[model samples]
Every structure is written in C-alpha cells, then in structure tokens.
Target: MRAKHNVLLVTNDHVSTLTGMADNTITVSALDRTKVKINGQEGVGRDLSLHAVATGKEYVHETSKDDLWFFFDVEVASNPALAGVAGFTTFVMILFIISYWNSAGSSTALVLVALQILCFFCINPYLIALSDWRNFMTEEAEALMHSSVGMNKALKSVLTLIVLLTISIFAFLMLKSVLPDRSIQDMGDWELWVAMLFDSASLTLPFICFGLYTSLPLQVVQILASFPFLFMIFFSTTFSPGAGLEGVKGLRFLFARFYLWCVIPGVMEGMEDCPKDNLTLYTVLSGCLGLFLFLGLQGVLYVVEMNKANAAAADFKALQGSDEFKQLQVEMKYVHTDGTPRGFGQTGVDYKDGYEATATEDSTITVSGGAEPPANEL
Candidate 1:
C-alpha cells in the first residue's frame, strides 16, 4: 500500500520518521532535489532511492522555514490610515483658524493651533494601535513561537517619532503662513517647536501601549480610543483658560494636553495674556512621571497578553497533532492544496451541455481543473 505522511519541517536539520515496515525498499521524491536530502544522502535529481533497515526508519532534510514576522512592517510610515487622519485633522484646524482669523487674537489663535496639533498627535496612536493590534500581535507572537526576533517596540517608536516630526514641520510651515507676523514672532524659535514635537511624540507611546494592552471588541476599542480626545475637548485646557479642569494642577501634570498648555505658554513668554506661571521644572518632571507610570502599567499588561498568546499557540500545536484532526483532514479530499474546500465543481455533480462534472469527496481537485459550471446550471 502506498501511504503519504506529512511532517512539519520547522528546522533545516535532518529529521527521522519510523515507518514500522522492516527491510522495505523506499523511494523518496522531492519537489526540488538540491534542497532536500533522503537517508543522509542528497537526491540525485528529484528522486532518492533508499533501503530501509530492519528498524524501518528513514531521514529527510530540508531548509528551515522563513520567519513570517521578520518581513512584517510595523513602522508608522507604512500605515496610510494614521497619516490620512493626521492630514485631515490638520486641514480642518487650518480652516477653522482661517475662518476665525478676523475675530480672535493672534496669540490665542496660535495657541489654539498648537493645542489642536498636540491633540491630534496625542489621540492618533491609540486609534491606530487598537485597529492594528491583531497585525502587530500576530507577527510578534508567531516570531516568538519560531524563536526569532519580532517587531522591536523601540525601533517602531523611533520610526513613529520621525514620521511625527515630519508632519510637525509641515504643520508649522502651514501655521506660519497663516498667522500674522507678530504672532509668528511670539511662537518662539525652532528649538521650542522641536521640543514640543518630541514631547508630543513621546506622549503617543503610552496611548499605543494601552491600546495594545486591551483585547476588547472593535466597538469597545473605538469607544475607549475616543475617550482621550473627548477628555481633552471637554475638560483639558484646550479651550477657555478659566473654565474646565485647568485649576486642577493634578490633571495638568497627568495629561499631555494639559501639560502642554501649562508648559508652552510659559516657554513663549513674549505672548501676551498667555498663562506662564505653571511651567516650572517640577511640573515638567511631574509630567514625565505620569508618562512613566502609564508605560509601566502597559508593560505589565503586554506581558500578560504575551503569555496568553503563547499558551494558545501551544494548545493549537497540540490540537494539530491529534488523531481526530488527521482523520478529518484525510476524509476531506476534495480540497485545494492550501486546504480550503474547492468552491466550484466540488459536489460530484454532473450536468448537461456546458456544465462540467465535479469530483467526489474521495477525489482531489486541482485549481485549474475546478472551473465553475455554466451560469444556467446554477
């Protein structure tokens, strides 16, 4: 009897399987000769002939499978959703500023522009991380299973910072073009802008970490992601200076938007009627502490998720080795090479005229041979 067995070639090293048919002559064929070995000898062409000893054992060798996660691109530049959202928000803010240009004071308008930009950067990472968590975690988890290096969080963060910096420069140019000369002068130097951009990008990391830490449903994720933006709009120092949570020094230290409001106005001392009394070294250190606290909490959450994913992967591997699964796989013969059920001509039915015959469940079907029947045959 001719029997076929499937083995997982996880590594390049030789692996031996016992056939339990003593002293039998065996012939092995590979899709490629140079890439495979049989019984300690490389194939002569596509086939390798071997004599099994009384032990009924044979060895096969193949190259290692490439780690799928290594090729996954997690850098923010590859994600159009993030860039598109940022661009749209920037455009809308610019329009708002232009519409109110005649009524609002230039300093307040400039501050408003800065706050809007800061809010975009602050809220963006959470949404993106939540939406793309599966992609991120899948690659990382698989890479861990394969004992290979996965996506590096530090590397991704650095790339994200670079993209944010680029966007910040473009935003600055647009804001400069719109603002009056006096307001531009009061906006401080390039150093201040760079510092603010760095802080904004750093602020995004905690949000990203928090998003990845949660495994909620999509609706819940969206709701949770929107909370930060809503909080900024309603409570933070984004709008009226005298109203809504600005008096709460603890909030100013905890949230990035409030922290920016407290710090940036102080740094730009030239701007009249701008709040500057809150920007102290101690306040800056407090903001940093808040960021670190979030980072630590999210780090713990990530480790928990990683452990869960690893355990799930182990269970799946065990299930793959079960005899029931193997039996089911064998009974389902009319499947494509990739193991999907053939969609067309898969019911072993015959029709008249243009209709084609289909294979039975006991038979196999190739993709090219499984053409759809005529439309009239339905």
Candidate 2:
C-alpha cells in the first residue's frame, strides 16, 4: 500500500505535476524523469512529459486517456488481496486440473476450471486495480472517466446477477441429488424459478459489495443460511408433488427448470452426462453469458455517455498564458500541504507587503493564484 505514496502529487496522461510537503520543507524533484530536462526547470517542471523516466522508475502514470477511463479509478479501488489469492489458487488448481483435465473424471477437473473462469471474469478489474495511480486525474478526463465508471458498475451488477443465477441453478441440482428418487424433470414448471432468481441475487450481494465490503466468515454465514431455503424448495416439491404447479400457469409455463438445470450453450442440454454431478459446461456458459451481456450493454452506454462527456470535456483544458499567473511568479511565498491545494478563494488577499506568508481573517492562504496555481511554463 505504501508503495505508491507521494508518487504523483498530480498527473494526467499528457502531463505530470509535482508539489511539496508544505512550506517548502522538502525539495521535491521529478527529474522530469528524463535525462533531457527542458526549460531549465529540469527536475521541477510544471508539466513533464509522462513517458520521461527518472531513477529507473517509469514516470508516466498512465499512457493514454482511454486507460484513465477504461481502467484506472474504478478498478484500482478493488481489494488487492483478490489478485494474489486468485492467482495462487488458480495456479495450483490449474496444475492439478492439468493432470486430470481430459479424464472422464474430468468433472473433478472443474474445480480449477471454475476458479479460472471466475478469475477471467475478474481479470479486467484486477488489472484496473493494479493500474491505480495516486495522481489527480484531470477534469478533462472526468467525462469519459465517469462514463466508464458508471458503465462498469452497471455491467458488474448484471454480470454478478448472471453468474449467481447460473451457480444457483447448479447448486439446486446438487441439492436435488440428496434425495433418493427426485428427478428435476418431474419438478416440471415450478413456480419457484422467480424465487430462485431472487435468492440467487441475494447470494450475490457479497460479490457486488466486493470492494465496498468484505468479510469472509460473514459471507459464508449468509450463504449457509440460504441452503435451508434452497433445500426446502426441493423438499416441499418432493412431498406435495403438485405444489410446484400453480393455477395461473402463466409465467410458470414460460420459465423452465430445464433452462436452469440444463441448456449449456456449447454443450449438451440438461447435462445428461452427469445429472448427479456439477457440470463444468454450466459454469462455462454462465461466465460466457455474463461477458456477452455486459459487453452488449456496455457498448451502447459507452457511446451515449462518452458522447456527452466528450462534448463537455473540451472546456476542461488548462488555460493558456493568463496574466494573473504572471503576478504569482514575482511576489508569493507559499507553502504546500502534502502537494495538494488547501482551498480555492474567489477574491484577492489583503496581505501586507514583504510578508513571507500571510493568512487573512478567513484563514485562507493568500497565494498568488487561487487553488489552481495557473499553469507554469516549464
């Protein structure tokens, strides 16, 4: 976590800005991260080229505006532990599955295979989190950034739902296997499909809240609590037989347990090969459908939201050669607060001449410029 501290101060794909630890206590240098320093400012250039390198570390926070939107802010905030745990688990499971991947008992191979599927689903988010930068993303990038963020949220929500529905269906089959003589086919058109979707959605709340909240034991408890209800759905149907059916026969006819229990897109339907075992095909189809649905909706939303953001984004660029910025060069002795602006004031300051630093009665620092120190020529 400390690896990225004090890294940016501020940056965008086009430029990098370095500030200070207030009152000029520490002299910060960027080296422009380049051997060829421009403008004599060299180490302290106001807007350094992003690709410039210093001290062997890469200076650019991100290479393009697309990355700032497509990956940075939203994904970077996700739990870091996920990558390590997922990687190690996937690695070991993969090795084990490789040994048995082609065996008829390959159903057992589904363990790592399922995890790898989940890992792939997590890939972009993990990369985004890894790409997290400490710099301030420009307001110019905000429109596209915000759009990307919103679209990701909606996408993950839908994806989380799809996977949960698929897994819940599989879990239901496992529950049914517990009974000696139950056949999912006999359940026919259970009015319970609607309930199953909701239950599955509830189970998904943990993943939906992945970065927002994480408590493994609590999550396990929540899932364990659902098992009774899941089992009860089959148990009741087993006893009453006719209870799974209802008088209206409306959506029940439209909703098929076969869709939930079977219907793997690229594989056989109803999982005829292994009715009693978990189907790898189901897991694969679930992940695939989730990706398809997310990409489909995300494409539409990106066009719409990005168009609006792009239109508004033009005005967010830094102003060129304002006279007010010229004055700050001559007569301001200001301090920084960890390289971030303290406040933005709308009016001029009444500082006495020759004062090293002055604060008005309002307690705001009277810097030559407001919170936005006008862009300086390197």
Candidate 3:
C-alpha cells in the first residue's frame, strides 16, 4: 500500500531551505542481482544526483487548515444544471403555493409545501449530499431495502390526509393558464364546474406517476419525477413542520421513510422530553419551509425561462428585419440596374445610375418631414 501525504505548508518568506541527506552529503550505492536472472544480466546500478537552489531573502512559515464549506458550496454552485433546476423548482413552488395565502382556507398541504421549501434553503449540504448519493448509488446494484409499491401506497395515504393540497396547486396553475377575467361578478355554475374539473385534471398525480412508469423513455425520469416530492420531504425536515404535520402525514410511505428514519431521529435528539406540539410544529414548519424554497426557486426559473424565450423571439424578429437579410433578399432578385427587369448582364451604366439615384432619393426621405432641398440649390 502506498502512503498518502497530508502536507500543509504556508510561507511568508522569500527564501527557505530544507534538506534531507546522509551526513549532509550526496552518495549512491548499487547491488548485484545475477543470482535470480536466467539471462545472467546484472540489474544493479548507482547514480548520484546533486540538487541546489539559491534564495535572495528569508521568510516565515505557518501551517493552516482549509475551510471545508468553501469547497462544498463551490461544488453545489458549479454544476449549472443542478443549480438551475433546483433554483427554478424552488422558485416556482414558492410563488404558486404561497403567493395566494390571503385567499380561501390555507390547507395543511400548502403550509407543508411552503415549510419544505424553507427547509431546502437551510439544508443545502444535505440536499447536495443526497443528490450525489443517488447518482453514486445508481451506478451500482445493491440490496433493495425498500419496495416501490409500498412507497407509493404510503405516499397515497399521506397525500389523502392533507386537505385541498392538490386542489390548490392545480387551481393555481390552471388560473395562470386560463387568466380569468377580474370583472366577472361571479362564476356561473358551469364555469365553476369546468374550473374544478380542470383543477382536478391538473392535480391528478396518477397520470404523472403512470407516465413515469410507462411513457417516459428517459432513464432519469423516475429521479426527476421524485424530485418535487423529495424536495418537499427535505424542506419539511429542515424548517418548522408545525402547521404542516397533517401534510407530512399525508406524504406517501416511501417518501416519508427518510423523515421517519433520519429527520425524526435528528429532531428527537434535539428535543429531549419535548411536548407533542413541538414535534408537530417541527415537522410541519420544516416541511413547509423546504417546499416554499423549492417552489420559490422554480418561480424564478419560470420567469428566467420566459425571459429567455422572449429574448430569443425578439432576436429572431430582429434578424428577420435586419439590413443583412434585406440585402440578401435584394441580391437574390438579381434585378438589372435598369428600371426595366432584365437578365444579369444586360444593364448599362445609365441603368446603374438610375437605380443608384432612386435608392438615394428613397434613403433621404423622412416620415415626419419630407426630404429637404439640395444644399447647393438652397
């Protein structure tokens, strides 16, 4: 086994010398190995080497420790895809879930989602570590400690416990999609039914889950699909999970396993002989915070993507009307300089003169004020 070195050196000096040699002198030795060679070739030799350096000044040195957080943050921010995806998800969830807190009865699920978002912001390292762990674990096959079906059942049960959680999320998105008129005094019975139907359709997770199981061709679909819910889990664990306990209780079993195995244990460790409210509060608040953070990030991402799309459209429009494109169009026509349309080589200088004169005249006209008289004539 080769030994690894953990060397920490710091110097505030211009010159320093450290040497390790026998008797402070260089020497060499050789050994003969004819005893084990079938070819009878001797395999021992000696070489003497001298190394020297001159320094102009003296300096001091000290050993210092490196901050680990700097590297961790660097790794997190350096991955463009991860940062963008995480940030966007956080933004969108926050905006969608919490932006309308003033209206209607805020459900346990929304509160939980908001708490989860808060958690995500707080548990930055844990999120990164978990992400890395998944990537690493995917490369190797291991014993299945848990079942997917069981996890799904647990999730369904948990989600069922939370009131109007799905409806709110779906309704928020549907409203955005439909942009309802504010002047309407009230929704007609049919309109309300239609909106509810739309919300129900939007909130339907079966299709998304089924898509994950059936339609999605990508290898990472499962991972991506789990991203939103897992982030909720992460947030719940991090922030105050008080108001969101019912929501956490609603999380499917497989997703809740981590909270049961890890987050609960940590929280328990922190709170010795604590009351039930503390537990509820911790769970709900933590979850809501994480959800909020994730959605908030997602909202920002939506705006960013929208802006990018707009900018791209504007650029395309600009290119379409650009001078270069117009020039290309004119060149393609190959209209002879003469006013009369003719083949490429048929035009004379008189034709060229007329074309140039017309072009100049057209160029000089202003919309607000027509072309001025020639300076010499004025």
Candidate 4:
C-alpha cells in the first residue's frame, strides 16, 4: 500500500517545519514490474507489485505527545469561560480588599463582606451548572446516575458547598494576613471567627437550597437568589441606623442580615448597650431559622412538582377519554394491515365519506367534520 504523510507542527515557521519534516519523513520506492498479457492486448506491467516504505513511527510519536500537550497547555489555558469565572472572582476579591481598607477596622463590615463572598461563591456555581444538570437528566435515566434525581442534585450541591466554603475561608484568611493594617491576630478570637463562619454558612444555606430545588427558569431563579442580598442592603439594619428602632427590631426576623448581625455583638449601632442575653438568643434562633427555611423550601418545591405531575396526568387521562380521541381510534381501525385506508378499494365503504384526521402543528388531532381538539389536553 502507498504510504501517506500526516505531519503535526506547532507553527508554520521554518524552524517548526524543519523539526517536523526531519522526524516524520516517509520514503516509498516502486518495485520492478514484469510484462503481462491482457485479454486483447499486452501490457508491460506486473500482475502484482510491491514497494518498500519507511515506518515513520516518529510521526505518530511526535503527534501523540505534542498535539495533546498543546491542546491542554495552550488551548485550555486560553479558554474564555474558565478565564471569565476567575476574573469575576478576582474582581470581587478586589472589591473586598477595598472594603477591608475603608471599613475603619470594623470587623462587622468585614464579616458582612465575608458572608457576601460566601453567598456569591455558593450560588454562582448553582446558576452556572443548572443547565449542565438539566442536560444530564435529559441524556441519562435517573436510575443509572443516582438513586433519584433529588438525591443526585443534593449530592452535587453538598459537594459544591463544601468546596466553595473551604475556598472562601482560605481566601478570607489570606487577605486578612497580607493586606495593610490587617492581620488574622486582630480579627478576634478563633472561636468567634469559627462561630461567625458557622452562622454565615447557615445564613447562606437557604439560598443555596432554593437554587438547587426550585423548578423556576434560570433567570427567575437568579433573580430570586439575589433577593436576599438586595433586601439586606436596602431593607435591613446591617449598615443603617435603625437597628434599635422599635419598628425595625420587631421586623428583624424577616431579613437574613438581621440574624447574622445579631450573631456578632456590637455590630449594630445603638445595640452595643443591648443585653448579651438577647444577642445569644438571636444567635441560637438564627441557626434554627436557617435550618427551618432550608427544609421548608425544599419541601415546598417537592410538593409543587408533585402537584404539577398530578395535574399533567389528570389532563392526559381526560384527553384519553375525549370524543376526539375516540374518533381518532375509530378512524385508525379502518386502515388495512399494510397501512392503506380500508375504504380506498373496499366494495361498500366510500373513502370520501370517511372522516379525515390530521394532526395540527400543536399536536392536537382534528377531524374533518368535528371541532378542533381542546388545547388544554395534556
């Protein structure tokens, strides 16, 4: 067989061309031919010919090593999607750095910033990966991938939460150490930081759970995921002077920031003189409230999906019993075994008199002499 050359070069430069050709050159030589006689004419060629060819095994060797190396080292390194996420994370970190410098050594603002970072890290991935989860469900059966769809979703969510939380904590500590006028030592006791981290995660849990379990579209889900942050910024007393106002205090539970604010003492203005007993009570209540919201939202989503499924099934059953479906079945019965209408050549039945059924673009079956099927069926 004639040999073919397939060269892989890193660039079109002369250096790359020489390097590629030197290692991947192939040589072929024609063999001597003998005279052969055809049916009507004689030809000066051998019945069978052979040629010597070089293996050029180095061509495959060079390609195997260099192609993959270039793909992963160069192509993947330059991918915009990966760069976008990293750039966004860096931008957010820059904002936090600015906040660190401007907060006037107030740990409350820093902790709030940390919680915002935690929430962003946790929910951003959910928004980005929702389409992937949907695609996976569409392409594979639930039984093959996990015990159930909910279990698979929960597993993914839990793993992502752990990873993002670890990363956020590490980033926080690193920033605290390297930034001017800030050090981990001045961030207060380790136990307080630990408790703050726990409460922050608790505050973030319900939003994460909502993103995971809700059946809403991606845009709507994202808007809902952002509601807590917006509410905290504009409606809560986190950065405002209403912390001790009677009306604001009464409605504090409605805002997630209030729970977090209560967890850290002296964070709220006018509340520094408040009793520690009340702050401790709010701390305990925050944990309980987080758990309650998390589970309650998941349960509500499950019920909503179940109700949707039941309504769809009921509609399908109603469609099955409808007169249009009966007419379709009757018309189908007159078809011959070979799929031709029995009325076409039958002696007694006239095909013209028979009902003609055509399915519309919306998939509703219609008969020539009857009203169009209802759009609400299924």
Superposing all C-alpha atoms, what RMSD in Å does each candidate have to the true structure? 16.4, 17.5, 30.5, 24.7
Tens-digit lDDT string for candidate 2 (94-211): 4544553333322322332243234334332432231122112232334333333334445445544554455445434432333222232333323223333432332233334432
* Cα lDDT listed for each candidate: 0.46, 0.34, 0.34, 0.47
- Candidate 3 to truth, TM: 0.21
Model 4 regions more than 4 Å off? 1-128, 135-139, 142-148, 178-188, 194-207, 243-248, 254-256, 259-269, 272-291, 297-378
Lowest summed lDDT over 10 consecutive residues: which window, candidate 1? 47-56
TM-score of each: 0.46, 0.26, 0.21, 0.46
Candidate 3 off by > 4 Å: 1-218, 224-281, 287-290, 323-378
In candidate 4, list every pair of residues with a backbone clash. Answer: none
Q: Model 4, range 1-378, lDDT digits (tens) per residue?
A: 012333333444445333322312222224423643222223423321111111123222222444444434532466454455556666766665665554444455565556466546644654565545544553453323213454445555665566455545755554554343443344343533453555455545545555566555666656765655565565556666365567645555555445545444446444333334554455446544655766886788789999999997787567655554443333334333444434323211233234332332222342345466566631
Model 4 vs. true fold: TM? 0.46
TM-score of 2: 0.26
